[model samples]
Target: MALRTGPGSPGPGAAARLVVVGTACVLLAACSPPAPPQVPAPAPSTESAGPTTVEPTADPWADVSDFVPGLVTWDSALPEQSVEGDPVEISLGEGEDPVGSFRRTNVGLSFEASDLADERWEPGTSSLTPLIAALNQPSLRFGGNAVDRRVWWTSSDESAPDWAEFTIGPDDLDRIARFAEATDASVTLVLPLGHFDPERAADMAAHAERALGDRLVAVAFGNEPNGFHHQSQLDLALRDEGWDAEAWVGEAEDYGQAVHDRVPELAVDGPGAYDAPWWRAFGEAEIENKVALSQHWYPLWSCPDRSGETEERAEPEVENLTSQWLHERAETVFGQGKDTADNYDLPLWIEETGPTSCPGTNDSSRTHAQTLWTADFVMIGAAVGAQRMNHHSSLAACRGGAPMSMVCGMGAVPNESPRVIAQSNYLALLMLSQVGTGELVEISSSDPEVRAYAVAGEGYTDIVLVDTGEPGTDRAMDLSVDADRLHGISTLTAESLEATNEGRLRLLSEADAVPDSLPRGSVTLLRFSDE
Candidate 1:
């Protein structure tokens, strides 16, 4: 617009102004303004925002370690299964009776006297020694078929044969006395009832008293008269014995009464049967303090279809049946009775019991698991208040069959030795013995797979835990204690769930090392020091 200015000033100045304006325009054009490049709003995280979510993986059996302490009882025959020098150290509660292995009944190993003699009996403190030592077992019932065949009592034979000649002779009594002297065990003898000779039965009792003297506990009058009728039928068939049930029962009562009159303090027990008839009969007869009630238990009767054929193949249904049978029998017999501790009262003893009667058969009691189950039975029986239990085991050699042996069957077979070889039952006894003697305390846990029992002793509290769940299932448990009562803990576990042999008893040294997890199908004993 100012084109007509001074020739040099206006023209030059105007030109400079135009150059400046052109430079500013060029700079503005070169500096292209960055246009907003679009970015799709980060696809809403498929996962909800805040904290990164993590899905839990599939985990079954997360809480299977809970358990509760149950009742406990003692099987008097346990010590008889021990090796002599291996004297098991049992812990009894303070102020409790110092009870050791006491023989509650006497039943010879199902072998003849000659067979036992030829087995080369040993004299040291070993398993065999204990068996021989327990020969003086008191309150015995010698009326069974095997007893009639094996024992040569003076009543059966007028020779008044000593125990050396009989299945349990003077030599056996001497050994028992020595064992008692060493291990503090007592004796209970049950006289035989199969033949039912009162005079003969009394003579046998007199013979036992003469040999064992005051050491004798009591005499059991009959084998199992209540079930005698039924059992005799089967037993007679097995032994080819022409037995008359009615005649036998009458003879049994007479013999028992005779023994009762002769030895009132001998503490007799009887009607060792599964049914309530025996208890009712014994009560009705008014045997009073002179007699205690005795019973036999076989959680499983070895029927052809239900025999425990093999370790892995045995049916648990059979075991369940056995348990149910015992439980029902206990209720019927012990529950229906009167409450007084006098004339109308009688204490119950599980005189004879086991997994099977014919432990030597193909379907015999050879499995380790069977022994574990046996332990379960024993614990249950104790919980229910069965006074005492005697597991039927052979104390001598067997007399017949291939692969036939004591460890395999309930009956003693040929070539079987009583050196305390590992058997399912023996292992089970060991586990029970470890619990010692005490009033069973209470323990409870949430996991169904775990079962436990606590026993309080003078300086220790024993806790037994059994895991009955599937193999490899890990169980986590919270173990609480009476902080005021206990101080330290020691644990023992069955190293291998399938191991029924001696190796199953593995004592763990780390007392306070609570396991973060436990293997399936195991039993753990935790001892808490009272100090």
Candidate 2:
């Protein structure tokens, strides 16, 4: 007698379950109503449309490329942007202040001379020789927690000094001396502050003076003292040893003074800090000009939680953060009181920076894309008037530790040699080194993603264009360049993007160069000789 339309249909006592099910159904129906059926509106007749007029909107970016020619400017401190063949002349004679031509900042390797053994020192010599030849690095820093008195000396006995047990013993010193002599690279020594007595500090400077002789350009008292708060430690040590931290800025001034007194020619700078407080303190202290300002920057480490991520995402973020910080810092430090010409006199150097110290950091460090990005960073820093940029881990083989050797593996496994491996950063630096020494000129393109910079050489012009956008999107940039005059152009670019051979950037001919399409994630360096 049960009325049922189907199995489990509501029967005698099923009304209770049915009500719950029915309520759920109603709620679901209310939650997700069916989309209203689309109804096409009636089309307007040709007469009613009135010739189908289109509205015009003003484009603010229109004719932006046209302004490229007039944007050229001149500067005496650095290279000038000039028309390739224009009669606007500047002095760039041979041996005539090479600083103007030395636009490419050389990032030299940092490590202690003591960690190297005699056999290791010989190969290190050969390894660094070619690198120095290739990069023309101006200065090298020796001391990165590796050259501490504890690591270098045989015993802790202060009275009976075994100078033979020190890392800067006769053999290692000889090798460094010979290496510097053979290659025209200058040396920058960092004396250990944590473990050494003042006498050892003085002795270390004396030994460096004798070993390196005139090759030594500068000495940094301690490494990252602001970060370590070693200033307080040095202050305590000085007070305990009956020296005044208030009279001086602790060991930085003391050791620097000692080194300066010993070698009057050698430059000294310090409290190498990651924060602004140390820089402000050092700047306000009326320190000698010979004591240069020093700071270390690792844009990735500044955001440690995300340091090992891929550059595709991380680099842009880091760039933005760094640019913002640098701009604000520059404005705070140098942006006041001038007719836009002579605003601030302080010269800052990015003493250390790199992609990341995390071993898990993306392979972008070894890619050509990284090279382009690094080159862009260099150019941007230079454009903003940074004195120098020393990329961190330039020599460090492993992650999160001092460099094991001048030549070792970059990642966890030691497959590729850091010195010999042709990383994108290495190639980028190489390409930059080849261009003539002149000032940076302005170039414009329709694409916002395409960054263009031009530098006038002695007799030629170098134009560097970078496309920093997502891959697979072809950037159609209408590049309008105004040089002294147009002559001929030589283009250099990478032909491939596949992982295996991506780092290969070649000088392409006019026929092969001007492609209807450029590969995604690539850089083009074009050189134009004056007619």
Candidate 3:
């Protein structure tokens, strides 16, 4: 049977395929004939057992309603695991409401430049269009570390090397603009600053501005210049010329100014940094002309370079993928960006981030855990006052290339494949997009395993609870709200944290609702309305 890959399935992208394949291999192994049992002589210690029987244990949740798969159970009358028999109170009215709106651009996506020029992107037939619509975000960024070496396919006569990757031209940009129009999303094209061709970049930028018109948000220069080889190469180039952080600034200024001079309407975003030192320095120099402070972040090395091979990386470790760890990392990185943005009076944009860098992880990045992690990461980013959080994916995976990282390419089905599978992370983003803009009020949970946040929408409140625990860990939160009624309780879950079932967002009414007892390794959202 053909594998139906995508967001909710066992993963259609290369990375998810790897996980699925690995699991299949294990299952295949189990189906094979077992070796002859090497039974040791019976131990002299114990008396012979009657059929080696095992004792039956009481089911703690038997009296409680059985958890129906794909149903939101929201009954506060259920028993609370804590002492005093009360749900853990999440105090919301005490603190000043942190009011903010979630913009269409707030949940953005970053991809390779080549994806913009692919033929498969044709509006009516392409599988990527629906996926893009599901995001419902206002901005889409075309660039990654790939921009460091990307060439503009300027001429048909320019026969490039097999390894060479190229970006779109005016015609390609027009096609992409149509895509943006279809999805109601804008485009942010990152120039090839690593190539350092101001004239060429300016020409491309000008053409893009004309093609995309108001759909263009901003053009960033390069990807992570500081952490990648781009910076090292620039350092070497500076040996002959004046070299310093200002040198980078001067180069960016020249490139950006050239493009700006031609496409005055397009804003320039830059000095994409991955760390505090680089961001602080880059922000200091580029803050004047830049519209936003762009940066990249990964909790730890998702790719092999920072560690070893994909299989060797520990990104999937349940201990590390916990809510506490992810939340802490978000605080640290977002805090730094927030500080820089505050210091320079600029909006901070996390232009690139994922479960890891380089390529995506297998079991870790492709599992249910990532879905929960993504929910918390995005909400935390919004709460931290970030202007936008752009999830990074590659063209290869989207087009059914190879599996790379947790934020694997989103195309789901392989290129030219009949069906487009949505990866798990994409589904997670789709669920997140449903959260309407409002003040992300504070959610306090006494239990560390459970993390909660509330969006105080004018007359409604959206409560999100994530359980980052091993399977069988029971959790519920007593969310005290002033609303007269609560509705739209839903949960995103899978058979196991590692299972790639594509899960789903199941809606439940008050009768079907179970008090915030979110299943282990899942995310639950509750809507409370004054009406």
Give residue 220's error in model 1 in angstroms.
1.1
- For candidate 1, the lDDT comes to 0.40
Which candidate ranks first by lDDT, i.e. highest?
3
Off by over 4 Å in 2: 1-125, 145-166, 230-248, 285-291, 302-346, 357-360, 363-365, 394-420, 442-446, 476-501, 507-518
Predicted structure 2, TM vs. truth? 0.60
Compute the lDDT of residue 407 as modeled in candidate 3: 34
- Candidate 2 residue 395 C-alpha distance from true site, Å: 4.9
lDDT of 3 by residue, 1-531 (tens): 001112321101212211112111001111111121232222111111111111111121121112111222334433333212223434343233433334445677887776666665566565566556556543578887566665554523456546456645677878887777776676778887666677777887887778777677678766676644333244323133334455566677778778877876567766677767666666666322467777788774544444334443335454566647567777778877877877876677778777765353455656677767777788777777776678876545544353433233344533444234456665566566556456665445555666767665544456676777664443323332212234455567665677653555553334235443344566767654422
Cα lDDT computed for each candidate against the true fold: 0.40, 0.41, 0.56
Tens-digit lDDT string for candidate 1 (256-302) = 66766675444566656665555555555534334456667554453
Q: Write the per-residue lDDT of candidate 2 for residues 204-291, one digit (tens) a residue.
A: 6666668777666556665565534333234223124433323336556666566656665655555455655566555545334343
TM-scores of the candidates are: 0.60, 0.60, 0.74
Candidate 2 local Cα displacement, residue 50, angstroms: 68
Task: Tell me the TM-score of model 1.
Answer: 0.60
